[model samples]
Target: MKLEHVSKTIRHKVLFDDISFQIHKGLYRLTGKNGSGKSTLIRLLSGLSAFDNEKRLKLEGDVLFLDLNPIGLAPFSIKDNFYLLCKTYQVKLTPELEANVEAFFSDSYNDDYLHASVGTKLKLGLSLLLVKEWDYIFIDETLSTIDNDSLKIVAKQLVKLSKTSTIIYVFHNLSCLLLEQNSRILHIEGGKVREV
Candidate 1:
């Protein structure tokens, strides 16, 4: 997605201004200090929240924002969550898709399946980027629980998924997410984004 002159303001507070950036169809890491408007920018881009009057938000293609909270509802396993996500997107969940679900969840973790740990639950969420084929995917600092090995796998999956898509990932650990040097990094500070 391409953003030009996008800014957000609340009351008398100015979040950011004249924020213009062009992101290619690849993985991007958004890193910033605490309370740096990282989450706010993610919300604005994902359509979860609206930008203030001064900011202009625009998207060149499809986008989906994955929520940060990993705590899903009861009676909803990894399998069930994928099913519901596919259904909500009006996509057909075929047998092959189900098998991909199992493989993605199991392979990301070394476990035989997705019932391994709380981290796996996070992996389940990451798996959504691959399953739904969204043109743009926004992950809001959601990989905190993800470990090294799983992170490598997830990173690879993200790259593969981005072959025909764009990913705006918010990560605290820049090194982990930057395994692929080609990925762009954006730092948010004082309620503004700057490339670093």
Candidate 2:
């Protein structure tokens, strides 16, 4: 997919200025310093945000974006929230999905999901990424604060998911996992995008 001649501005300041790039199917690590336009560019590339189009915008896909806190209600039981998420995504609930959720939630499937730690909740959400099909998956610093074990599991799932979808992991800093995994790098700086 290519983003050609795209510009993004918020509050009269342009974060990205008429940038263009093409990337193919695979895992990509998007790196930039803080306050750079990495997340904005990811949103634009995911087709979640509209940009100033010097040419007609090009990127298109079913996109899943994980930005740390997932879409679980604080008052909802883990099972209810999981079911809600599946319903929201139109994923047919199956035995395999149930088993995965059970594993993620452990013995607390009936308890309010927010009662569990953040890492556990993140695992529950990431599990569904394995169950669903999508064209693009944008992870914006979702793994930065998770436990090491959860990070390892989510990284494995992401690597597996990249076989069929364009996975973009966005963070400000380089990660060992991103380097070791079969992933390419895209860095943003000074309102421009480039492969590094």
Q: Which one wins on lDDT?
A: 2
Per-model TM against the reference: 0.78, 0.86
lDDT of 1 by residue, 64-140 (tens): 77655664444556566666666667766667767766766665433423354677766766766555677878888
How do the residues 1-196 of candidate 2 rate in per-residue lDDT, one tens digit apiece? Answer: 8776778888888898878788888889988888887777777777667786533344465678787766688788778888888888888878976886676555777877878777667765676775787788888877776666556666777787788789898755545564355778898889998988
Q: Quantify how close model 1 is to the true structure by its C-alpha RMSD in Å.
A: 3.8
The number of clashing residue pairs in model 1 is 0
lDDT of each: 0.68, 0.75
TM-score of 1: 0.78
Clashes of each: 0, 0
- Model 1: colliding residue pairs: none
